[model samples]
Target: MAHSSNDEFFAKLVELFDYRKGKDHGSIVLTQKRLTYDQPLPEATSDTILPDLHPPQPMPILIRATNAKGKEKRRAKEKVKLSTVVDADNLPAFFERYAEVCKVGMNTLKPRDRRRKGKAKKKKGGAAAVGGP
Candidate 1:
């Protein structure tokens, strides 16, 4: 049995995606693949004030599950959409869940090229950058 309620399911979804910022219009906009910063976003448990993406995928997003539905099943058709918007408060949990669904284990994601955006700083500088120095 699915133990999660509708609200719980949706809440987790929001968390997995991080609220960041979305359009204020009544509908949420779906993005085409935005080349990820090519770096894994900072993890959620950071003691810092804000998190990059709750679930963190090292690669750019090719698709959002909410926007994953389509007539061809594998191809995204224009008329397909599973969700339009998510609540901001639920962002934390949803982003995690989505990462899991996508199999983004801590060390499993492939390293992506980040030089296009003017050279992404790698943390080989150590945890110091994340406040650990």
Candidate 2:
């Protein structure tokens, strides 16, 4: 039963493939389109309709900082996104490779310490520190 379901999903995924184009990275627009492809459109009940697509832009305050330090901070954090549309045809292969890598990564990953490292504890036996007047 699970095998048949997986097959069906694979078939659907293959149907969305574009053979002419290929990519090594993901795209937000493509992801959104793929996600909402089969979904039913909402009824236009209201007069005011909002647009769906909006590109990311840096905050005005961050870009136009009063001090040099603020501008330097923004420059340090800001990164250019070099995105390309991923080939839908290679999706299954890519996912399989990703899964294998993840399995290996999980094996190599070290367990993190959950305890918070706070201020050092004061000496309990020191008479000078706890002495009463």
Task: Compare the candidates by TM-score and give the number of the best one.
Answer: 1
Model 2 lDDT tens row, 1-133: 1112323433333332221125333221111123222334444445535322321221111000011223566589532211122245555665585355334433324454233232113334344434744
TM-scores across all candidates? Answer: 0.24, 0.22
- Give the per-residue Cα lDDT of candidate 2 at 22: 55
Tens-digit lDDT track of model 1 for 1-133: 2224435544544543343224222222334353344455665554754565444433333333343334675353433233323334545675666556444322333476455434334544433534642
Query: Which 10 successive residues of model 1 have the least lDDT summed?
Result: 19-28
- Pairs of colliding residues, candidate 2: none
lDDT of 2: 0.32
Q: What lDDT score belongs to each candidate, Candidate 1 first?
A: 0.42, 0.32
